[model samples]
Target chain A: MGAKRIGKQTWKPEHPPVIISAAAVVGPFEGQGPFKDYFDHIYTDIMAGERSFEAAEKEMLLNACFTCLNKANRTPQDMDFFLAGDILNQTISSSFSALELRIPFFGIYGACSTSAEGLALAAMLVDGGFASFVLAGTSSHNASAERQYRYPTEYGFSRKPHVQWTVTGAGAALVARDGEGPRITFLTVGKVQDFGIKDPLNLGAAMAPAAVDTMVRHFADTGNGPEYYDLIVTGDLGKFGHSLAVKMAVSNGGFDLSKNYQDCGLMLYDTRKQDVHAGGSGCAASATVTYGYLYRKLMDGELKRVLLVATGALHSPVTCFQGNNIPGIAHAVSLEMI
Target chain B: MARDPKRKPLTVDQKRYTEMVRDLVPRPPYLRNSLLAFLFGGLVAIIGQFFTDIYRITMNMSVKEAGNPAVATMIFIGALLTGLGVFDKIARYAGAGLVVPVTGFANSVVSSALEFKREGLVFGIGSKMFILAGSVITFGVVTAFFVGLIYALFVF
Candidate 1:
């Protein structure tokens, strides 16, 4: 049997793929966050014993992948495909880590929404009998991202209150054909939505529309209401984007997601204590939260059903400098523990 | 500032959505930020004045001659604070207050130098040291030249 096509962009696989094992490895700052206990390994040094911040980011991704493979009692040779990405030039972290893993790799990029994108594709591969086990992973580092996108680490630039702090972490999940874990039941692919927001710093406002659009589409496609899932989590909308999503979902889609809705950006850090202006962002924001915290919740039977919508801002430094508005994208994956 | 001809105009729904987002997003506290900038900027000027006085009194230099030493002292202090990782912390709250002085220029150069030091000394630190401050220098010199040209041609 083949994968079933649902409403619009959603897909329902004939045999749902199982997320067997997931792991999260974070840097020192993320280790101090509220969900620190859920993470597998926490590096005290941001460098992760590496010389460059880029090298450190690669190390975190490799660590997460290995930890995930080990947890499932699987080796790198056992995996069929390695799907990974990061917020770096050419997705270097993923490609470099794939070099070490030696798994046939597919390097992807959806900005911060890479985790869900990988998961959806992994599920398709598994359900289609293309692979028995596929490793889906993604990572992002604060220093590396800052140096690439905004400024240097030591630059004395004042961040606005709406500016989000990029998360320094990596997360990986092993998706298999048969396993005793949460199943990937449904996936809703989002279209790129541009709201004509030009401020590169105000990412939350830019990405909110795409996140809401995906959420509304997911519900409409699956014929599920806001209350159908135990929890509905968005990738890195932060404070402003999360509220905007809540409002837009109601106004546009006629879906009230005021309850049982949380953003991984907000959940990853303590906004009051941590100096993260809005909240944590980057690819790792959703990857770590969903793979570590939400995965555990599913395993422990705490949450029977969950809708994970990871949002991404599709803008480059060149585009931003050229005054092009940032386009946003989001992909949703429904996890159900039968 | 004409709109880009290639870009399509915003639709009615898109315009309404933009308005809603504008309302939802929080605006920075401009009044409070301005007051902080003013207070801190005043403090920086006072410190500069003190350095100028010290140079004038201790070395018996003229006010005009002491100005160079005073500016140098302020820049040195700024570089030191930036190296110690204290300038950004203070700048977070001080806003334009800490950024309007010569100290801000020092911070910009030193910070870029420190950040790019990993790439190597010549290509990294030497070339990139002026990455941020180059703009200020270029524009400053150009504006000064234009002003002087105007004075030479007309007033002078």
Candidate 2:
């Protein structure tokens, strides 16, 4: 069997990689969220007994990775590659976890889209026969993200309605050459899109264009309409961005995403009750939802095919403050239960 | 909305998309927010007056002299609430009500101090303590200087 390239950006590998096992570890706040039962482990303390938020993020990622490996009955030495990323500066959470795991690591950075990005790359590696088993993971902490991107956690600054709360959690998945689990069927890499959005607080608006672009491209490449997938989920467009993406998809792409479309941000927390103004946004937003809740759905034969389009705002505080527009990216991975 | 002169001009498609997003995104409830701010701000003022009255009665100080101690007490309470992680939760609902008071200033300073304490005393707590409050202090002093200069020139 030969590997097939579809359309411009989508790829159909000869041998689709199987996600053998996956795990999600969340903080106390996220544990109280709607999808709490799906998560493998929930830390009662946000600090997770770590001295700092950064260390706690790393610990969550490490816990996720180990939980995933333990579920598959695989050890660290069995993994051919460990690809992970985080929203932190230099992706420290992932790199520190890689150091402890002692796996050959590929440190990636896609902001909030990191989980899907890692999954896509890990699938490619397995399909191309470069590796047998790969661990792809990502993590984000609300306090750490707030410290780096916005003001201090305790600051009495009022948030705008569009402002999203960063999720405090980590998610990891084990992709292998052959396994009895969900298979990565199609992958569509996204192009960075900027619509001259400058406000860092309104990341949903900044990121929606890229998500729509990727989804449209995925549909074009696969010749599959929105109805083909039982579920179509975005990474972290929150409420506003998710709506914008739906509108853009219809107006620009000539496709209706009114049905079978949801966002991880909206699924994670009950926005009405939670003080998270818009919704959750971070690397773990899509990650935990897909790996924990959605993965379980697939295993239970609830969903046949699901399209995961993880969106990201590729902007730093320095860049945003420097009067630069925020560019957005999204990667789509079609997962089919096998 | 007036475009920022410093920002690069958007392309036609980009401008159209931006307009679409702006229309689609929900606007903040100004009327409700204003009402909350007004009520909360009045409550804070009432609390300050209570403190001032207590100071006047106990220390035999003039109303003018009691004002400073009352403000200092408010700042102390603000710092305590911030440390307990309660002020931010209130600020979220109170909006400008809590943020436009002396308590907000204390929160700005204390929050930064607590956030950076892990880094150490000099570089973290000391330097970063003014991260948010620095702007307020800077503009406050500058405006005060100009006001003082005008008073000296016109009224003196």
Candidate 3:
């Protein structure tokens, strides 16, 4: 059907939504990363003068949202809607920050995949003639997530090699009805997939199937293979998940991403020196990497097309504690330069 | 080891795949960890007692009351040490010992907050400050309540 809806959940908008401006805010650990130059802001103090980690996360989201708006010389009033989320209990970090922004807010909870999900939704909104401009953002703080998912920092329990460090950063993008920036062309929403994983430590393995499933769906829906995009990036599969996704795609989905594929988790830190175990993860895993580093490359004419697949493990402490399997989801958004 | 009959068994391919992955990964050192834990745990406890002595002698507080300020001081020192990046090194060396005290908790909070500080204050520090420890507090409180219930029912 030429009606924009493709074979499955992929939405190929007649008018692709344009990302006019974007910003990525990272923390000290990320600031020391190889992609340090990609960040817009980095703080030395983890506290950044906030009383608590939750407040710090809220601040990061607000700052990124404002930074994105300011880049376009637009105010909160200029924006039609604010779509944001984080890896926090009830996603209070996003909703509380939304209250301050005063824009028509839509709080999402796709766990760490919130960045891509927000982008996809914002693109659909802009393309569907719903809003002229919208802000899509997501964040994660190391401390906030560690406590919610695992033991308190004080417990000092040794971490497993498979465990990925939660990224402590925020990324925001300003999507416009029409602009002179990279345009969001296609959107692929993921289905929840679970391969019967129980241990929360092996998230990469848990999330790999979801990423592969979404990747397959995106290719099927768009009728385009891996050759279509200049780069294919996953939010935070780390190393193991990235390889597993490739293996799954090649064997089951009949697609190969060997040439142009990267994982934000692996890119965000120096695993050798950083001691991040499997690498970095969380909302910022995709947000900062795509918006700050990759988007910069796109604008600099280093790349033409990019397909960002943000992955999330939909597992809560309650679920894991209750001995339930971890479900995973991934969303993809294709960006093309105008 | 007794196998669970109720649990679904892994397929042959899945079993092989697990073995392949496990083969590549090295086993973690447990002996070294125990030694460090013993040493570091004792050292940290000694430091806590020192602070307790200071609070008791200088602040003129009783032994029971001195612990509050001592624990608070230890937390502050732990956070400070973590901020300077000293705690991490100690943690790496001391292993489990570094993880058992108020200082370890401080390190967790400080390190987690610091990890994302650049993301901004509200979310980076405020939000992540408790990620590692929030569960501990919640569970600790919950367990205490249940234990208190038992005590009230039987003893108190």
DockQ of the candidate models in sequence: 0.57, 0.57, 0.15
- Which rank order by lDDT, best down to worst? 2, 1, 3
**Candidate 1 lDDT, tens digit per residue, B88-138?**
889888889998899899999998898898899999999999988999999
Per-prediction TM-score to the true structure, in the order listed: 0.97, 0.97, 0.78
The TM-score of predicted model 2 comes to: 0.97
Tens digits of per-residue lDDT for model 3, A1-338: 54888988899878888888899998899999999998889867665568877888888888888888888999999889999989898899899989999999999989888999999999988988999999998999987787678754434456666788998889999999887888999999999986766668878877887898898999998998999999999989887788888887897688988999889999989888898988888998999998889989888889989999999999997777766667899999999996
Off-target runs (Cα >4 Å) in candidate 3 are B1-89, B96-156
The stretch of ten residues in a row with the least summed lDDT in candidate 3 chain A is A151-160
CAPRI-wise, candidate 3 is incorrect
> Which has the better DockQ: candidate 1, or candidate 3?
1
Candidate 1, RMSD to the unseen true structure: 1.6
TM-score for chain B of each model, two decimals: 0.93, 0.94, 0.84
In order of TM-score, best first, we have 1, 2, 3
TM-score of 3: 0.78
Q: In candidate 2, which residue pairs get closer than 3 Å at backbone N, Cα or C atoms, i.e. clash?
A: none
Looking at model 2, residue A239 earns an lDDT score of 90
lDDT of the candidates, in the order given: 0.93, 0.93, 0.85
lDDT of 2 at A64: 98
